[model samples]
Target chain A: MEFSSKLLQNAVHEMSQLPGIGKRTALRLVLHLLKQPEERTEHLSNALVKLKSEVNFCKKCHNISDTELCEICASTKRDGTVVCVVEDIRDVMAIENTSQYNGLYHVLGGKISPMEGVGPQDLNITSLVQRVKEGTIKELIFALSSTMEGDTTNFYIYRQLEGTEVATSTIARGISVGDELEYADEVTLGRSILNRVPFESSIKAT
Target chain B: MEFSSKLLQNAVHEMSQLPGIGKRTALRLVLHLLKQPEERTEHLSNALVKLKSEVNFCKKCHNISDTELCEICASTKRDGTVVCVVEDIRDVMAIENTSQYNGLYHVLGGKISPMEGVGPQDLNITSLVQRVKEGTIKELIFALSSTMEGDTTNFYIYRQLEGTEVATSTIARGISVGDELEYADEVTLGRSILNRVPFESSIKAT
Candidate 1:
């Protein structure tokens, strides 16, 4: 798209470089910023700059943090023996929101997607294996999504801990809590049946 | 959503302030930036800040420009007697792409929408009326969208220039160039029929 001003064009071009944002969307967003108070743009730019320069990744879990070790890894209340493995900080946040697990988290940073040229080594897999081998974590729960890439990542990590003391488990696959049983995918329904737990245990957990 | 880091939250919040971006998309974009080289973030932030600080609006037409007068307004080859009144620079670019209009443009900045608390006073209507009253412009083509707000803004400007010598007209409303007539909306089809141009003129123009 033709822009009247070089400055506007530059800003839109930079914005469009983001994933899922096209040139038209970038122009719309940049124009919206121009229509707003100057401080709005300042705040946005300043925040991005500050975050990029100052934010830290936890040395222990690789989660985004304000310090060397993230809060969950450093907290005394969270169970260090059980570590929930996730794709990124977003997953960490999602699991934290459910209030279901009080275990610590290990951020894989990304999945093993060969189609995108992202292999096991491209993520934080080595550090995770090192942590598990250190004998601190007793159980490793696979909380990645149910995509093929997610499964490959899980199996890769599970194989890495072949002779280790850490027990490996995956999050349940089933119909959603409020979804109709008929609408469940065949693979998920079959897995749910095969992995069925005791009725009393499910009742107690609920 | 809960964030593991305060800096991450602040950055996401600022990113989400842009129009049409929500918290999830903001987080995704921010995370994508984090995953990219630090220079990517630096470039994006710097471009936005530079654009906000240094961008200028053409003094004559209010179109975004690097100089006091935009290229269209400064060009002597263009017809100063005819000005196309539009909502903003986007419309100006759209019209310029058509390569049909060789006249100057007067940007209104926005439309008259009471629901959004935007009235004629909030727009660039006053200077436009003053420009027409100066007796330089002979005709104004209303190139604003055909929305209710666009029509209201057009009528508002038309009333403001009541005693002026300028003749006013609107862009045509009809089936798009390649659109099937059977699928055309009733309002636009009826208007196209009522304002039909001579078959000979249409053939010659095509």
Candidate 2:
């Protein structure tokens, strides 16, 4: 698509570089910005620049933060001894929304996907190992997705903790509470049955 | 949703202010930028700032342009006497892409919509009238959308040109090419029937 102004074209070109945004969408967004007051565009640009220049990662957990440590990592209330490993900050937000886990997070940044050239070293695995070796963590919970890359990353981290005394566990895989048992995939259904909790324990939660 | 960083949260808030973008999508886009090299974010920020601060509109046609007059308006080959009135620059690009019309364009910037508090005074309608009053323009084609607002804007302009010697006409409304007659909307089908052209003239075009 041809643009009437070079500046408009450049803005759209940069916008379309983002994931899932195409040129047409970029043009629409740029045109929308053009229609609005200049202050809106200034705000957006200022925010992006400030975010890039000022944002930092938590030194302990690798989560996005404004300071040396993320809130969760620095929180006295959260259980630092139980680190829940996740793919990214979004997972941290999702898990935090549930309010079920009181443990601190260890953001891996991403899963180890060989096809995507994302290896164990490319993630925050080394720091995670160091955290485990510090002997403060009692249990490490694997909270990544149930994909092959997730499993591979989990196994890699588990191997790294071979000599450490930290106990390792994974979030349970099962049918959703409101979902029908028959509709559950075979792998999830089979695992739920094989790892079934005691009847009394399940009854107590409900 | 809670954010680990205030800077990240602020960025997401500002990004979400854009049309069609929400907080969740804003967070995703911000995180994606965070994952990329810092230069990518800087480039995006710089482009938006430059576009907003430096972009200019064609003085004659009101199309977004780098100079006083747009390329089409300055072009000697384009028929200056035949002016096509459009809602915005996007319509100009759409018509240009068709490669059918050789006329210059007068971008009204927007249609008159009372619901949105937009009136003819808010648009480039006055400049259009001035262009017609110059007596250089022999024909004015209303190429706005087929919506109620588009029709109202068109009629308003037509009234402004009531005493002018320039001929006025609207772009045709008919069943689109390759469209099935049975599936066509009633208004468009009815208009096509009422404004049917000579059979020989239609045959000659094909």
Candidate 3:
């Protein structure tokens, strides 16, 4: 193929390694870069190069940050008494987008999967226990997925903080979303029935 | 979002700016990068930064190259007397993959689209005319598309080289591919029939 330059060809090859991008798409992107002002490509390249060099993990919550601590961990307005545990940074983004909770987060990096050879030792469980040992945290929320590995990880963390004052809770999976009572799955319906709340406010919207 | 590091966010943001990539896809790509060693991200970043800085256009044919001339232009075995003009570098790769043509190529970068405000001046047409005037080229093949803009660009170039000794030609378009004779459009079928070669030559396998 008659590439305009060796550097362009090399860039296309590198880009083609990405998921869903073929040689043609890569070439198109390179050609587009050629048409754009040099600054745009420079911006992207600088960002990429500085990504690992300038950025570091927040020592407290594992969120990305320019400094030692993430904004959430460094903020006094956030509830430090409540800790929401998750499997990865993506879950933190999901929770943040909802804007429902104002508590802190603990990213485990991954869930426990015995078959995959990843156990509690491979996760950030020790650091989490050290947080609970500080004695100010009241509730430990397990916002993990309902998958088997996620459940296993949740149970492991629950057992670790069993004797502590931190009362553990998990996100309920019943009545989810837009489904009516009749349309709910049997397992979900059963879970909802078992975890039913006591009547305090009128359901008829008085 | 709880990112592993600040670089992760920056990388994802840059990736998301590409033509079709979205936030989630960018995040996925960044996450994949994090899983690999430092060299992977560094390699890609270096390639991107060096793409424009290290490469320039081939002065003679306008193809991409590290030197003043591209591989096709530099190759001694390729047909220097014939020039195939195309809309973009992707077309160069497509034709090269066929291994059927050994002629040189000229990349126009784009077709002349009045709606997009692209004119002849914006393209590499002047260089093409200069090349024709040099008197080394014989066949000037217009391998551009059959669309209105493509046709207009071809006609414009044809007019520009009117007095030159070079013989201008357009690539044939007919009932493309596996199209049945019954379903073929009138224009295509008529052209195919009118341009049909002698049965004796095509009957024997090449």
Model-by-model lDDT, in order? 0.93, 0.91, 0.83
Whole-model alpha-carbon lDDT for candidate 3: 0.83
Deviation in Å, model 3, residue B142 alpha carbon: 1.8
Model 2 agreement with the true structure over B1-206: per-residue lDDT tens digits: 79989889989999888878889999999999988999999899889888888889999999999988889999999998999999988899999999989999999989999999999899999999999999999999999999999989999999988889999988888999899999999999999999999999989966
lDDT, model 2:
0.91
lDDT of 1 by residue, B19-74 (tens): 89999999999999999999999999999999998989998899999989998999
Candidate 2 Cα RMSD (Å):
1.8
In DockQ terms, which candidate is top? 1
TM-score of chain A of each: 0.96, 0.94, 0.79
Candidate 2 deviant stretches above 4 angstroms: A180-184, B203-206
State the DockQ of every prediction. 0.86, 0.82, 0.50
Ranking the candidates on DockQ from highest down gives 1, 2, 3
lDDT-best of 1 and 2: 1
Instruction: For residues A1-206, write the lDDT of model 3, one tens digit per residue.
Output: 54656688789998888777788778777778767787778877777767756667779877667779888899999999999999888888899888879999998888999898898998889999999999989998999998899999999998888778888899877886567999887988999889876566425423
Assess the local accuracy of residue B201 in candidate 2 as a C-alpha lDDT between 0 and 100. 91
lDDT of 2 by residue, A1-206 (tens): 88888998899999999887899888889889888999998888888888888889999999998879878888899887899999999999999998888999899999999899998889999999999898899999999999999999999999989999999999999888999997899999999999999999999978
Native contacts retained, all candidates in order: 0.90, 0.93, 0.69
